[model samples]
Target: MINYSCINQLKTLKDIIRYTTTIFNESDIFFGHGSDNAYDEAVYLILHALNLPDDNLDMFLDANITKNEIRKILYLINKRVTLRIPISYLTEESLLQGYKFYIDKNVIVPRSPISELIQNCLYPWVKNPESITSILDLCTGSGCLAILSALAFQESMLTATDISVEALKIAKKNINYYNLQNRITTINSNLFDDIPIHQYDIIICNPPYVNTQSLNKLPKEYLHEPMIALDGGNDGMDIIKKILKNVKNFLKKEGILVLEIGNEYNNFVKNFQNINPTWVTTINTEKSIMLLNQEQIP
Candidate 1:
């Protein structure tokens, strides 16, 4: 429990940021979602708690906060420290490529670096970005990627699928929130089992690639997220294998598959030795995501 009386003494936004950063450092909470450091996380939490714009952080740095506001901030900060809850779930929102999406424990927080590629419209990878009429976002948790794709490829309609009904529900909420109902469709599918045999010009996924050993070692923050979203089997290639085997059936002759497999680079290379994927580079992590054309898959 947090002591409201003591927190009320912290008058300004700067004061709260410093205090929260200290508590986060002391708690040793994991931070794999977007912000990497304690100070950045503190700034994010404080800004959202105050309903202020992150870009205008400097404008609110020294702004005085009321006792009630301080109490609310402290409560959130304490929950993050003591409970190890992800800050995104605490706020029920997350940002990707400067776009906001609704998030909860029902689906993993939208943290894929693929958002960068979508924002750039997959340029250089796709020969005709404007002609991309159909897209598939497999394992589309909260439909963040699907929504982004809808915006990226204005001519495209998407089929976003996930095995979890709860995740699909959250994905629907996001699709509705973004007013992307016309361009995006959500499906409950185990890989491609429930999805119809439809071809796509592009297929994007940030699937579960965390191996069993890595899953066990994940921080308490991850435990709040669905295990189905993280566990990628013994060697972390179970879901990847299934996707590789069936993806060619749904992709057009020129279609490409973009997949994010975190920290499983070596395993990916070893498992699919015959098939070669053109690895996509992101600003934050190198070789974490890869691209494959329909012809590359056997």
Candidate 2:
């Protein structure tokens, strides 16, 4: 409900950025989709709405904003605050490790710390990235990881699998956008159900590991993502457990499984006491993602 007066108050890009930040800070909005704070998110939204490059805000700060543009940006901000929609969903795009991909409500936003590990090509663990020939990205919503894997392991081929047909559509869209159709393929599968019994050199998954209790307490923004992409049953291990059970069948003898269970580390330890996994430490956390070798699964 932006009126003429409110619109009148914001005339320049800086004004909109300031006002948007103030309102965002004043409101109870969450900010995990991309930016971590109000000011950053505001600048990003303003730059994006203006069709300006997102990286440079100071360059366009004093530029005057027209009334029509102001209304458009204001409407975007209002929807973000009122509906709690993630900015990526609002903008129809997402970034993972600086690589951009088209995004929509059908898929969860790509925020996996695995992107960091991928950028490093699994490094010490995967001593020979060049030797890796096949990769599998499970629960690959929007196919961002599959695309990243293709870029990182240029010599390797990949298969991105998802249970939801709608989600697979987005994944394929991204895969095609990156012009990796020949290297990566999409499969409609309930985990391993429909996937061919081909083994992979690496299998990475940022599956739904939000426990029931945590899912119940998720911010409104998370509710906008598909429940199947977050709800991991009572212990946040429903999908994880299934993944572990069948992983051995799809992984090469020397291959590895990289799983992101997020805060479910404690639950994982409790449930899978027999299997030991190495936690991948991002600059952010030590417990977000875990790695396991083929022998570790059985």
TM-scores across all candidates?
A: 0.96, 0.97
Candidate 2: TM-score?
A: 0.97
Clashing pairs in 1: none
lDDT of 2 by residue, 204-278 (tens): 999999999999999999999999999999999999989999999999999999999999989999999999888
lDDT comparing candidate 1 with the true structure: 0.90
Q: Compose the digit string of candidate 1's lDDT tens values, residues 111-185.
A: 899999999999998766789999999999989999999998999999999999999998999899889888898
The reply for model 2, stretches above 4 Å from the true place, is 1-4
